[model samples]
Target: MGWFSKDIQTMDDLFVHQLQDIYYAEQQILKALPGMIDKATDPQLKQAFEDHRKQTETHITRLQAVFRMHGAAVKGQDCPAIDGIIEEAEEVAGEVEDKRVLDAALIAAAQAVEHYEMTRYGTLVAWARQLGRPDCAAELEKTLKEEQAADEKLTDIAVSAVNRKAA
Candidate 1:
Protein backbone atom coordinates (compact mmCIF):
# COMPACT_ATOMS: atom_id res chain seq x y z
CA MET A 1 0.00 0.00 0.00
CA GLY A 2 1.07 3.56 -0.66
CA TRP A 3 2.10 5.72 2.30
CA PHE A 4 -1.13 7.64 2.30
CA SER A 5 -3.35 4.69 1.55
CA LYS A 6 -6.83 4.47 3.04
CA ASP A 7 -5.62 2.42 6.02
CA ILE A 8 -3.48 5.30 7.27
CA GLN A 9 -6.21 7.69 8.35
CA THR A 10 -4.79 8.47 11.79
CA MET A 11 -1.51 9.79 13.14
CA ASP A 12 -0.74 6.36 14.53
CA ASP A 13 -1.27 4.83 11.12
CA LEU A 14 1.09 7.33 9.61
CA PHE A 15 3.67 6.62 12.29
CA VAL A 16 3.48 2.87 11.67
CA HIS A 17 3.74 3.35 7.92
CA GLN A 18 6.87 5.46 8.36
CA LEU A 19 8.38 2.95 10.72
CA GLN A 20 7.84 0.20 8.17
CA ASP A 21 9.25 2.37 5.42
CA ILE A 22 12.45 3.04 7.30
CA TYR A 23 12.73 -0.58 8.30
CA TYR A 24 12.66 -1.54 4.65
CA ALA A 25 15.10 1.21 3.77
CA GLU A 26 17.52 0.08 6.44
CA GLN A 27 17.43 -3.47 5.09
CA GLN A 28 18.15 -2.17 1.63
CA ILE A 29 21.11 -0.24 3.02
CA LEU A 30 22.42 -3.39 4.64
CA LYS A 31 22.26 -5.19 1.32
CA ALA A 32 23.87 -2.29 -0.53
CA LEU A 33 26.74 -1.65 1.89
CA PRO A 34 28.65 -4.83 1.07
CA GLY A 35 28.80 -3.82 -2.55
CA MET A 36 29.82 -0.29 -1.62
CA ILE A 37 32.56 -1.64 0.63
CA ASP A 38 33.90 -3.75 -2.20
CA LYS A 39 33.82 -0.89 -4.67
CA ALA A 40 35.36 1.86 -2.50
CA THR A 41 38.94 2.68 -3.52
CA ASP A 42 39.86 4.82 -0.57
CA PRO A 43 40.87 2.96 2.57
CA GLN A 44 38.94 5.40 4.75
CA LEU A 45 35.86 5.14 2.57
CA LYS A 46 35.98 1.37 2.65
CA GLN A 47 36.37 1.40 6.41
CA ALA A 48 33.54 3.86 6.76
CA PHE A 49 31.21 1.62 4.76
CA GLU A 50 32.22 -1.36 6.83
CA ASP A 51 31.70 0.54 10.08
CA HIS A 52 28.36 1.83 8.93
CA ARG A 53 27.28 -1.66 7.95
CA LYS A 54 27.71 -2.68 11.55
CA GLN A 55 25.90 0.40 12.70
CA THR A 56 23.12 -0.36 10.29
CA GLU A 57 22.73 -3.74 11.92
CA THR A 58 22.37 -1.99 15.24
CA HIS A 59 19.86 0.38 13.72
CA ILE A 60 17.80 -2.57 12.51
CA THR A 61 17.83 -4.13 15.96
CA ARG A 62 16.81 -0.87 17.52
CA LEU A 63 14.02 -0.58 15.01
CA GLN A 64 12.81 -4.02 15.97
CA ALA A 65 12.80 -2.95 19.58
CA VAL A 66 10.83 0.09 18.70
CA PHE A 67 8.36 -2.08 16.82
CA ARG A 68 7.91 -4.16 19.93
CA MET A 69 7.44 -1.11 22.08
CA HIS A 70 4.93 0.32 19.68
CA GLY A 71 2.99 -2.94 19.59
CA ALA A 72 3.59 -3.46 15.92
CA ALA A 73 4.91 -6.45 14.07
CA VAL A 74 8.55 -6.40 13.02
CA LYS A 75 8.13 -6.13 9.28
CA GLY A 76 8.92 -3.72 6.49
CA GLN A 77 6.97 -2.09 3.73
CA ASP A 78 8.53 -1.62 0.32
CA CYS A 79 10.24 1.76 -0.02
CA PRO A 80 10.66 2.78 -3.64
CA ALA A 81 12.68 5.85 -2.72
CA ILE A 82 15.47 3.82 -1.18
CA ASP A 83 15.37 1.32 -4.04
CA GLY A 84 15.80 4.14 -6.50
CA ILE A 85 18.67 5.58 -4.54
CA ILE A 86 20.48 2.25 -4.41
CA GLU A 87 19.87 1.60 -8.08
CA GLU A 88 21.21 5.02 -8.99
CA ALA A 89 24.29 4.45 -6.87
CA GLU A 90 24.96 1.15 -8.58
CA GLU A 91 24.48 2.61 -12.03
CA VAL A 92 26.71 5.63 -11.36
CA ALA A 93 29.40 3.57 -9.69
CA GLY A 94 29.36 1.16 -12.66
CA GLU A 95 29.94 3.99 -15.11
CA VAL A 96 32.95 5.46 -13.34
CA GLU A 97 36.22 3.94 -14.53
CA ASP A 98 38.34 5.87 -12.04
CA LYS A 99 38.33 4.29 -8.60
CA ARG A 100 38.80 7.62 -6.85
CA VAL A 101 35.84 9.11 -8.61
CA LEU A 102 33.87 6.00 -7.78
CA ASP A 103 34.72 6.52 -4.15
CA ALA A 104 33.42 10.04 -4.37
CA ALA A 105 30.27 8.80 -6.00
CA LEU A 106 29.84 6.19 -3.29
CA ILE A 107 30.10 8.81 -0.58
CA ALA A 108 27.54 10.96 -2.31
CA ALA A 109 25.20 8.01 -2.70
CA ALA A 110 25.62 7.07 0.96
CA GLN A 111 24.87 10.60 2.08
CA ALA A 112 21.71 10.52 -0.01
CA VAL A 113 20.61 7.41 1.82
CA GLU A 114 21.49 9.04 5.13
CA HIS A 115 19.52 12.14 4.32
CA TYR A 116 16.45 10.11 3.42
CA GLU A 117 16.75 8.17 6.67
CA MET A 118 17.23 11.32 8.70
CA THR A 119 14.03 12.73 7.32
CA ARG A 120 12.10 9.55 8.08
CA TYR A 121 13.41 9.19 11.61
CA GLY A 122 12.89 12.85 12.35
CA THR A 123 9.28 12.62 11.26
CA LEU A 124 8.75 9.40 13.19
CA VAL A 125 10.07 10.99 16.37
CA ALA A 126 7.66 13.86 16.01
CA TRP A 127 4.74 11.57 15.28
CA ALA A 128 5.62 9.35 18.23
CA ARG A 129 5.46 12.39 20.48
CA GLN A 130 2.14 13.37 18.99
CA LEU A 131 0.85 9.86 19.57
CA GLY A 132 1.85 10.18 23.22
CA ARG A 133 4.43 7.46 22.92
CA PRO A 134 7.39 9.22 24.50
CA ASP A 135 9.15 5.90 24.98
CA CYS A 136 8.94 5.14 21.27
CA ALA A 137 10.02 8.68 20.47
CA ALA A 138 13.09 8.35 22.70
CA GLU A 139 14.08 5.07 21.04
CA LEU A 140 13.71 6.57 17.60
CA GLU A 141 15.73 9.62 18.66
CA LYS A 142 18.82 7.45 19.13
CA THR A 143 18.57 6.22 15.54
CA LEU A 144 17.99 9.75 14.29
CA LYS A 145 21.17 10.95 15.98
CA GLU A 146 23.08 8.06 14.49
CA GLU A 147 21.76 8.82 11.00
CA GLN A 148 22.77 12.49 11.41
CA ALA A 149 26.23 11.48 12.59
CA ALA A 150 26.62 9.08 9.66
CA ASP A 151 25.72 11.84 7.24
CA GLU A 152 28.24 14.19 8.86
CA LYS A 153 30.90 11.51 8.77
CA LEU A 154 30.26 10.93 5.08
CA THR A 155 30.52 14.68 4.47
CA ASP A 156 33.80 14.77 6.37
CA ILE A 157 35.12 11.88 4.35
CA ALA A 158 34.01 13.54 1.14
CA VAL A 159 35.46 16.93 1.99
CA SER A 160 38.69 15.78 3.62
CA ALA A 161 39.69 13.27 0.99
CA VAL A 162 37.21 11.77 -1.49
CA ASN A 163 36.32 14.96 -3.31
CA ARG A 164 39.95 15.97 -3.68
CA LYS A 165 40.93 12.57 -5.00
CA ALA A 166 38.05 12.63 -7.44
CA ALA A 167 39.00 16.11 -8.56
Candidate 2:
Protein backbone atom coordinates (compact mmCIF):
# COMPACT_ATOMS: atom_id res chain seq x y z
CA MET A 1 0.00 0.00 0.00
CA GLY A 2 1.03 3.61 -0.52
CA TRP A 3 2.33 5.76 2.31
CA PHE A 4 -0.81 7.87 2.42
CA SER A 5 -3.34 5.13 2.08
CA LYS A 6 -6.61 5.82 3.86
CA ASP A 7 -6.06 2.78 6.09
CA ILE A 8 -3.18 4.60 7.85
CA GLN A 9 -5.11 7.55 9.24
CA THR A 10 -3.76 7.79 12.81
CA MET A 11 -0.26 8.52 14.08
CA ASP A 12 -0.13 5.02 15.50
CA ASP A 13 -1.14 3.62 12.13
CA LEU A 14 1.42 5.82 10.45
CA PHE A 15 4.14 4.62 12.81
CA VAL A 16 3.34 1.00 12.13
CA HIS A 17 3.35 1.64 8.41
CA GLN A 18 6.74 3.32 8.74
CA LEU A 19 7.96 0.34 10.68
CA GLN A 20 6.90 -1.98 7.90
CA ASP A 21 8.53 0.31 5.36
CA ILE A 22 11.89 0.09 7.10
CA TYR A 23 11.50 -3.62 7.67
CA TYR A 24 11.05 -4.07 3.95
CA ALA A 25 13.98 -1.83 3.24
CA GLU A 26 16.15 -3.96 5.52
CA GLN A 27 15.14 -7.07 3.65
CA GLN A 28 15.91 -5.46 0.29
CA ILE A 29 19.31 -4.41 1.65
CA LEU A 30 20.06 -7.91 2.84
CA LYS A 31 19.69 -9.02 -0.77
CA ALA A 32 21.85 -6.19 -2.11
CA LEU A 33 24.85 -6.51 0.25
CA PRO A 34 26.30 -9.57 -1.44
CA GLY A 35 26.49 -7.63 -4.69
CA MET A 36 28.31 -4.85 -2.88
CA ILE A 37 30.66 -7.36 -1.34
CA ASP A 38 31.38 -8.87 -4.70
CA LYS A 39 31.96 -5.48 -6.30
CA ALA A 40 34.37 -4.26 -3.65
CA THR A 41 38.05 -4.88 -4.39
CA ASP A 42 39.44 -3.83 -1.03
CA PRO A 43 39.62 -6.65 1.48
CA GLN A 44 38.52 -4.41 4.31
CA LEU A 45 35.57 -3.22 2.26
CA LYS A 46 34.73 -6.78 1.31
CA GLN A 47 34.87 -8.00 4.88
CA ALA A 48 32.83 -5.05 6.08
CA PHE A 49 30.12 -5.77 3.53
CA GLU A 50 30.14 -9.42 4.47
CA ASP A 51 29.83 -8.60 8.16
CA HIS A 52 27.00 -6.14 7.57
CA ARG A 53 25.20 -8.67 5.43
CA LYS A 54 25.01 -10.89 8.48
CA GLN A 55 24.03 -8.05 10.76
CA THR A 56 21.27 -6.98 8.38
CA GLU A 57 19.76 -10.43 8.80
CA THR A 58 19.68 -9.96 12.55
CA HIS A 59 18.22 -6.51 11.99
CA ILE A 60 15.32 -8.03 10.10
CA THR A 61 14.79 -10.44 12.95
CA ARG A 62 14.84 -7.64 15.50
CA LEU A 63 12.39 -5.58 13.43
CA GLN A 64 10.03 -8.51 13.32
CA ALA A 65 10.25 -8.80 17.07
CA VAL A 66 9.46 -5.12 17.41
CA PHE A 67 6.39 -5.55 15.23
CA ARG A 68 5.17 -8.36 17.42
CA MET A 69 5.74 -6.21 20.48
CA HIS A 70 3.72 -3.44 18.91
CA GLY A 71 1.00 -5.95 18.13
CA ALA A 72 1.29 -4.97 14.48
CA ALA A 73 1.15 -7.60 11.82
CA VAL A 74 4.36 -8.40 9.98
CA LYS A 75 4.02 -6.74 6.61
CA GLY A 76 6.12 -4.54 4.39
CA GLN A 77 5.17 -1.54 2.34
CA ASP A 78 7.31 -0.23 -0.50
CA CYS A 79 10.07 2.15 0.57
CA PRO A 80 11.25 4.51 -2.14
CA ALA A 81 14.28 5.72 -0.21
CA ILE A 82 15.95 2.34 -0.20
CA ASP A 83 14.93 1.70 -3.79
CA GLY A 84 16.54 4.93 -4.90
CA ILE A 85 19.68 4.21 -2.93
CA ILE A 86 20.04 0.79 -4.47
CA GLU A 87 19.28 2.06 -7.95
CA GLU A 88 21.84 4.83 -7.59
CA ALA A 89 24.44 2.42 -6.34
CA GLU A 90 23.83 0.10 -9.25
CA GLU A 91 24.18 2.95 -11.73
CA VAL A 92 27.37 4.29 -10.19
CA ALA A 93 28.94 0.91 -9.70
CA GLY A 94 28.15 -0.01 -13.27
CA GLU A 95 29.68 3.15 -14.69
CA VAL A 96 32.86 3.10 -12.63
CA GLU A 97 35.06 0.70 -14.51
CA ASP A 98 38.03 1.11 -12.17
CA LYS A 99 37.87 -1.37 -9.31
CA ARG A 100 39.11 1.16 -6.80
CA VAL A 101 36.59 3.71 -7.99
CA LEU A 102 33.83 1.15 -7.78
CA ASP A 103 34.90 0.26 -4.26
CA ALA A 104 34.89 3.90 -3.26
CA ALA A 105 31.47 4.50 -4.73
CA LEU A 106 30.18 1.34 -3.08
CA ILE A 107 31.41 2.42 0.33
CA ALA A 108 29.92 5.87 -0.07
CA ALA A 109 26.62 4.42 -1.14
CA ALA A 110 26.61 1.81 1.62
CA GLN A 111 27.31 4.50 4.18
CA ALA A 112 24.36 6.45 2.85
CA VAL A 113 22.21 3.45 3.62
CA GLU A 114 23.75 3.14 7.09
CA HIS A 115 23.03 6.76 7.81
CA TYR A 116 19.43 6.34 6.67
CA GLU A 117 19.03 3.28 8.87
CA MET A 118 20.56 5.04 11.87
CA THR A 119 18.18 7.95 11.60
CA ARG A 120 15.15 5.71 11.20
CA TYR A 121 16.10 3.44 14.08
CA GLY A 122 16.94 6.37 16.31
CA THR A 123 13.53 7.91 15.78
CA LEU A 124 11.85 4.54 16.15
CA VAL A 125 13.69 3.88 19.39
CA ALA A 126 12.72 7.22 20.85
CA TRP A 127 9.11 6.72 19.85
CA ALA A 128 9.08 3.17 21.16
CA ARG A 129 10.52 4.27 24.49
CA GLN A 130 8.15 7.20 24.73
CA LEU A 131 5.23 4.90 24.01
CA GLY A 132 6.30 2.80 27.02
CA ARG A 133 7.42 -0.07 24.87
CA PRO A 134 10.83 -0.73 26.28
CA ASP A 135 11.00 -4.06 24.53
CA CYS A 136 10.60 -2.42 21.13
CA ALA A 137 13.09 0.27 22.08
CA ALA A 138 15.65 -2.32 23.11
CA GLU A 139 15.21 -4.23 19.90
CA LEU A 140 15.61 -1.07 17.83
CA GLU A 141 18.65 -0.09 19.89
CA LYS A 142 20.41 -3.29 18.90
CA THR A 143 20.00 -2.52 15.20
CA LEU A 144 20.89 1.13 15.73
CA LYS A 145 24.19 0.22 17.38
CA GLU A 146 25.02 -2.09 14.54
CA GLU A 147 24.15 0.59 12.00
CA GLN A 148 26.39 3.13 13.74
CA ALA A 149 29.25 0.67 13.93
CA ALA A 150 28.81 -0.16 10.27
CA ASP A 151 29.02 3.51 9.39
CA GLU A 152 32.19 3.82 11.45
CA LYS A 153 33.72 0.79 9.82
CA LEU A 154 32.95 2.19 6.38
CA THR A 155 34.54 5.50 7.32
CA ASP A 156 37.64 3.75 8.58
CA ILE A 157 37.89 1.71 5.40
CA ALA A 158 37.36 4.71 3.16
CA VAL A 159 40.02 6.75 4.96
CA SER A 160 42.48 3.92 5.15
CA ALA A 161 42.26 2.66 1.58
CA VAL A 162 39.07 2.98 -0.46
CA ASN A 163 39.11 6.74 -0.86
CA ARG A 164 42.85 6.92 -1.22
CA LYS A 165 42.91 4.15 -3.80
CA ALA A 166 40.16 5.76 -5.80
CA ALA A 167 42.09 9.00 -5.91
Candidate 3:
Protein backbone atom coordinates (compact mmCIF):
# COMPACT_ATOMS: atom_id res chain seq x y z
CA MET A 1 0.00 0.00 0.00
CA GLY A 2 1.04 3.59 -0.56
CA TRP A 3 2.14 5.63 2.45
CA PHE A 4 -1.25 7.32 2.97
CA SER A 5 -3.23 4.44 1.61
CA LYS A 6 -2.56 2.08 4.49
CA ASP A 7 -5.81 1.29 6.24
CA ILE A 8 -4.83 2.36 9.72
CA GLN A 9 -8.17 1.95 11.42
CA THR A 10 -6.53 1.36 14.80
CA MET A 11 -3.29 1.82 16.65
CA ASP A 12 -2.36 -1.75 15.91
CA ASP A 13 -2.67 -1.10 12.23
CA LEU A 14 -0.52 1.98 12.51
CA PHE A 15 2.05 0.10 14.54
CA VAL A 16 2.30 -2.67 11.98
CA HIS A 17 2.53 -0.17 9.15
CA GLN A 18 5.39 1.61 10.85
CA LEU A 19 7.12 -1.66 11.50
CA GLN A 20 6.97 -2.42 7.81
CA ASP A 21 8.22 1.03 6.94
CA ILE A 22 11.31 0.69 9.10
CA TYR A 23 11.87 -2.79 7.80
CA TYR A 24 11.99 -1.38 4.29
CA ALA A 25 14.24 1.44 5.41
CA GLU A 26 16.69 -0.98 6.95
CA GLN A 27 16.85 -3.00 3.77
CA GLN A 28 17.64 0.14 1.83
CA ILE A 29 20.36 1.05 4.31
CA LEU A 30 21.81 -2.40 3.90
CA LYS A 31 22.00 -1.79 0.16
CA ALA A 32 23.52 1.66 0.57
CA LEU A 33 26.21 0.82 3.15
CA PRO A 34 28.38 -1.18 0.78
CA GLY A 35 28.66 1.80 -1.51
CA MET A 36 29.40 4.05 1.41
CA ILE A 37 32.05 1.68 2.59
CA ASP A 38 33.60 1.77 -0.86
CA LYS A 39 33.45 5.56 -1.08
CA ALA A 40 34.91 6.22 2.35
CA THR A 41 38.51 7.47 2.29
CA ASP A 42 39.29 7.17 5.99
CA PRO A 43 40.02 3.75 7.41
CA GLN A 44 38.02 4.43 10.56
CA LEU A 45 34.99 5.64 8.63
CA LYS A 46 35.18 2.61 6.36
CA GLN A 47 35.30 0.30 9.36
CA ALA A 48 32.36 2.05 10.95
CA PHE A 49 30.23 1.49 7.86
CA GLU A 50 31.30 -2.14 7.73
CA ASP A 51 30.44 -2.66 11.38
CA HIS A 52 27.09 -0.97 11.02
CA ARG A 53 26.35 -3.11 7.98
CA LYS A 54 26.80 -6.14 10.17
CA GLN A 55 24.65 -4.59 12.89
CA THR A 56 22.00 -3.87 10.27
CA GLU A 57 21.91 -7.56 9.42
CA THR A 58 21.11 -8.31 13.04
CA HIS A 59 18.51 -5.56 12.98
CA ILE A 60 16.77 -7.18 10.04
CA THR A 61 16.65 -10.44 11.93
CA ARG A 62 15.19 -8.70 14.96
CA LEU A 63 12.58 -7.06 12.76
CA GLN A 64 11.65 -10.40 11.33
CA ALA A 65 11.16 -11.75 14.84
CA VAL A 66 8.98 -8.77 15.65
CA PHE A 67 6.87 -9.57 12.61
CA ARG A 68 6.44 -13.12 13.86
CA MET A 69 5.41 -11.77 17.24
CA HIS A 70 2.85 -9.50 15.64
CA GLY A 71 1.53 -12.30 13.39
CA ALA A 72 2.38 -10.22 10.35
CA ALA A 73 4.25 -11.38 7.29
CA VAL A 74 7.94 -10.62 7.15
CA LYS A 75 7.99 -7.91 4.48
CA GLY A 76 8.50 -4.21 3.95
CA GLN A 77 6.72 -1.27 2.40
CA ASP A 78 8.43 1.42 0.30
CA CYS A 79 10.17 3.99 2.48
CA PRO A 80 10.77 7.11 0.45
CA ALA A 81 12.35 8.95 3.37
CA ILE A 82 15.26 6.54 3.55
CA ASP A 83 15.56 6.50 -0.19
CA GLY A 84 15.81 10.26 -0.37
CA ILE A 85 18.35 10.42 2.45
CA ILE A 86 20.53 7.81 0.81
CA GLU A 87 20.21 9.44 -2.58
CA GLU A 88 21.30 12.76 -1.16
CA ALA A 89 24.28 11.06 0.43
CA GLU A 90 25.33 9.58 -2.88
CA GLU A 91 24.92 12.85 -4.72
CA VAL A 92 26.91 14.81 -2.15
CA ALA A 93 29.60 12.20 -1.97
CA GLY A 94 30.00 12.38 -5.73
CA GLU A 95 30.22 16.16 -5.69
CA VAL A 96 32.91 16.33 -3.01
CA GLU A 97 36.41 16.52 -4.53
CA ASP A 98 38.61 16.28 -1.47
CA LYS A 99 38.86 12.97 0.35
CA ARG A 100 38.60 14.58 3.78
CA VAL A 101 35.60 16.64 2.73
CA LEU A 102 34.01 13.55 1.28
CA ASP A 103 34.53 11.76 4.59
CA ALA A 104 32.89 14.67 6.42
CA ALA A 105 29.98 14.65 4.02
CA LEU A 106 29.65 10.91 4.46
CA ILE A 107 29.54 11.28 8.22
CA ALA A 108 26.86 13.92 7.91
CA ALA A 109 24.85 11.73 5.59
CA ALA A 110 25.17 8.74 7.89
CA GLN A 111 24.04 10.79 10.85
CA ALA A 112 21.00 11.93 8.93
CA VAL A 113 20.05 8.33 8.30
CA GLU A 114 20.69 7.42 11.92
CA HIS A 115 18.57 10.30 13.15
CA TYR A 116 15.69 9.10 11.00
CA GLU A 117 16.10 5.59 12.35
CA MET A 118 16.24 6.83 15.93
CA THR A 119 12.91 8.56 15.54
CA ARG A 120 11.27 5.55 13.93
CA TYR A 121 12.56 3.06 16.45
CA GLY A 122 11.64 5.33 19.33
CA THR A 123 8.09 5.56 18.05
CA LEU A 124 7.93 1.81 17.46
CA VAL A 125 8.99 1.11 21.02
CA ALA A 126 6.31 3.39 22.43
CA TRP A 127 3.65 1.98 20.13
CA ALA A 128 4.55 -1.58 20.94
CA ARG A 129 4.14 -0.82 24.63
CA GLN A 130 0.83 0.91 24.01
CA LEU A 131 -0.28 -2.11 21.98
CA GLY A 132 0.46 -4.23 25.05
CA ARG A 133 3.34 -6.01 23.36
CA PRO A 134 6.15 -5.42 25.79
CA ASP A 135 8.01 -8.23 24.15
CA CYS A 136 8.12 -6.43 20.84
CA ALA A 137 8.95 -3.19 22.59
CA ALA A 138 11.92 -4.84 24.25
CA GLU A 139 13.21 -6.12 20.93
CA LEU A 140 12.83 -2.73 19.27
CA GLU A 141 14.61 -1.15 22.21
CA LYS A 142 17.72 -3.10 21.33
CA THR A 143 17.74 -1.67 17.82
CA LEU A 144 17.07 1.81 19.18
CA LYS A 145 20.08 1.59 21.45
CA GLU A 146 22.20 0.50 18.52
CA GLU A 147 21.04 3.40 16.39
CA GLN A 148 21.81 5.85 19.18
CA ALA A 149 25.26 4.40 19.62
CA ALA A 150 25.93 4.58 15.89
CA ASP A 151 24.92 8.24 15.82
CA GLU A 152 27.14 9.05 18.78
CA LYS A 153 30.05 7.24 17.23
CA LEU A 154 29.62 9.21 14.03
CA THR A 155 29.62 12.44 16.03
CA ASP A 156 32.80 11.45 17.83
CA ILE A 157 34.46 10.59 14.55
CA ALA A 158 33.37 13.86 13.01
CA VAL A 159 34.59 16.05 15.86
CA SER A 160 37.77 14.17 16.46
CA ALA A 161 39.05 14.05 12.91
CA VAL A 162 36.81 14.20 9.86
CA ASN A 163 35.53 17.72 10.31
CA ARG A 164 38.94 19.11 11.21
CA LYS A 165 40.52 17.33 8.29
CA ALA A 166 37.92 18.83 6.00
CA ALA A 167 38.70 22.29 7.32
| TM-score of candidate 2 relative to the true fold | 0.95
Off by over 4 Å in 3: 1-3
Model 2 stretches astray by more than 4 angstroms? 1-3
- Against the true structure, what is each candidate's TM-score? 0.97, 0.95, 0.97
Model 3 poorest ten-residue lDDT run: 1-10
Tens-digit lDDT track of model 1 for 39-148: 99899889989999999999999999999999999999999999999999999999999998999999999999999999999999999999999999998999999999
**lDDT of candidate 3?**
0.95
- Candidate 3 structure quality by residue, lDDT tens digits, 60-167: 999999999999988898998999999999999999999999999999999999999999999999999999999999999999999999999999999999999999
lDDT of 2 by residue, 1-167 (tens): 55387987776776787799899999999999989988888999999999999999999988888899899999898999999999998999999999989998998899989988998899888878777888888889988998999999999999988898899
Using lDDT as the measure, the top candidate is 3
RMSD values, in order shown: 1.3, 1.7, 1.5
Better of 2 and 3 by lDDT: 3
Report RMSD for candidate 2.
1.7
Which candidate would rank higher by lDDT, 1 or 3?
3
* Clashing pairs for predicted structure model 1, backbone only: none
For model 3, which pairs clash? none
lDDT of 2: 0.89
